[model samples]
Target: MSAPEPAKKPNAAPPVTRPVFLARATYRQRRMRDAAALLPILGALLFALPLLWLGQNGGEARTSHVMIYVFAVWAGLVMLSAVITRILGIGAAPQSASDDAGAADTRRG
Candidate 1:
């Protein structure tokens, strides 16, 4: 059994609240990985701007359809190579687990 108390302190400390959530640094790492994905898209946008400008006159090609088809295939191969390299991490993902670990150590250090 406990006795009831009726006492008041004139200067009581305020109640404290702590934040409820925390995040992993790997989240930032994943964000950087996603940003690496955006590079090819940036490159494509860069390539598109000049084509858009050139076609601003809305002129048709004088060559036969075969020429257009061949160029399309050539462009496809180049874009495919870019996509494959980007997907395989040739851009900015820094190539090695060793590098990732070294970065982590550097950040900590």
Candidate 2:
């Protein structure tokens, strides 16, 4: 007689995991928020870059050039923040007149 076959191993359950991809709108919103969160850090790093030039070329970097760079970065950051805010629907109008009325009533009460 042939040797008895080995007992079959039980199947293990697959590991739990999140979906490989998020919904399109959700993914866009998350990326936008991430960009907003990182903006300040980016701005900080950019602002600091001018300091590195202080020691270069015997410190001959012009003040006006640095000022222009700083202002340009500032303006760019502002524009980026505005675009992100608009996309995120921040500062949007109230959904309805009733919502505004309710808020006013609560404030008065």
Best-matching candidate per lDDT = 2
TM value for model 1: 0.29
lDDT of 2 by residue, 30-76 (tens): 99999999999999999999887864568667899999999999999
Candidate 2 local distance difference test against the native: 0.91
What lDDT does each candidate get? 0.62, 0.91
For model 1, residues 1-109, the per-residue Cα lDDT tens digits are 8888879898999889866644666565566577666756865665454443323267753445545655675686577666656555566754698988988999997
User: Against the correct fold, how does model 2 do in TM-score?
Assistant: 0.71
**TM-scores for every candidate against the unseen true structure:** 0.29, 0.71
Clashing pairs in 1: none
> Could you give the C-alpha RMSD of every candidate to the true structure, in order shown?
14.0, 4.1
